[model samples]
Target: MKILVCISKTPDTTAKIAFADNNTKFAADGVQWIINPYDEWYALVRAIELKEADPSTVIHLVTVGGADCDPIIRKALALGGDEAIRVNADSHDSFYIALQIADIAKKGSYDLVFTGKETIDYNGSSVGGMVAELLEMPYVSLATKFTLIGSEAEIVREIEGGEETDKVALPLVVSCQKGMAEQRIPNMKGIMGARSKPLNVVEPVAADTLTSIASFDLPPAKASVKLVSPDTPEELVRLLHEEAKVI
Candidate 1:
């Protein structure tokens, strides 16, 4: 089986987000970048696990970014991706990004496409479904557990009120969140192997873009906390209703 795992570069969760140049761009100064947590922990790791269980299987990392993302892609490759394809493009909206990924998948014809439920930077859970739609394949979102039974895939997903499980055939897409697999760190051997492994970069195919970023801004800092006597339930309620309007 050939699994294509879509990895994204995300700002560290604790990085201070800010805008620059008249609110037209995200401030990168002093910010740290990391692999999107869900992508690393769930989608990518699970794909690695699948390959581990089946030596004949191959896991490939795919990213839609430029040279700036090469280091991160190399890190993912070191984490166990057999090879990688860097689709050279600046992704903005979900549709535009999905089109690029789908274009690559068309040529690769991967048995399975795995990606995180959402990118931590934008938190848009739209890419997987869009890619599936572009490829005319079945897609499962927020899958917590996955197992392959013969040629069929059994996926357990979390829904609003409960869990839903389903089975699907190959040539499918799955967007993973929590509970899929534990995160793995790349070892020195893997790192050395990654340097020798191929990191192919391909120009993006022409695709329609549905949207663009207008501006960037940060939410205001939270207000100071209010302290109330522990036993003063009535005062707390009154304060919440009158001052904070939290009730």
Candidate 2:
């Protein structure tokens, strides 16, 4: 089985986000970036579990970004990906990013592709579905469990008010989320091995940008909390009906 995992670079959760360049660009000055933690800890690691079960399985990681994303890609290589491919392009839009990833997956002849449910930064969970649509394959999203059964995948996921399972054929895309597997830390051996692994950088194919960010601004702050005396239940009810208006 050949598993292609899509990885993304994201700002560390603790980073203070801000915009510059007339509010049209992200301020990267003094900001720290990391592999999208959910992708690393859940999706990629779960795919590695499948690799461990089958020695012939080969896991490849791909990312859409510039040279600045290389170090983190190398770190993903250390985590377990046998090879890595970087689409040399600015991931300016979800559509374009999906196109780049889909093209690479097609060229690689990947049997299965995995990506985090969404990137922490953009929170756009569209890649897997887009790839599946482009490739004419099935896509299972928010997959919590994955097991191979004779060229088929037994996928389990949660649904509203209940859980559901599906058996999808091979050559499918899965957008993974939490509870898929335990996180795996990159050890010394894997780190050393990553240096020797193949890291391929390729120019993006001709693709049109379908969307662009106009500007970014912080969300409005929450309203100040108002305290109500607990001893006066009638007053609290009155407040809920009047000032709070939540009744």
Give, for candidate 1, the lowest lDDT window spanning 10 residues.
216-225
In candidate 2 the C-alpha lDDT for residue 59 amounts to: 95
Deviation in Å, model 2, residue 117 alpha carbon = 0.5
Choose the strongest candidate by TM-score: 1
Q: Candidate 1 residues 99-215, lDDT tens each?
A: 999988999999999999999989889999999999999999999999998889999999999999999998899999899999889999999999999999999899888988889
Candidate 1 displacement at residue 49 in angstroms: 0.6
lDDT for position 38 in model 2:
70
lDDT (Cα atoms) of all candidates against the true structure:
0.92, 0.90
Instruction: State candidate 1's TM-score.
Output: 0.95
lDDT of candidate 2 over 1-247, digit per residue (tens): 8999999999998999999999999898988999997788877898899888998999999999999999999999999999999999996688898899999999989999999999988888888899889889999998888889989999998799866999988999999888899877899999999999999999999888887889999899988887777787798888889987999
| C-alpha-based local distance difference test score of model 2 | 0.90
TM-score of each: 0.95, 0.94
Clashing pairs in 2: none
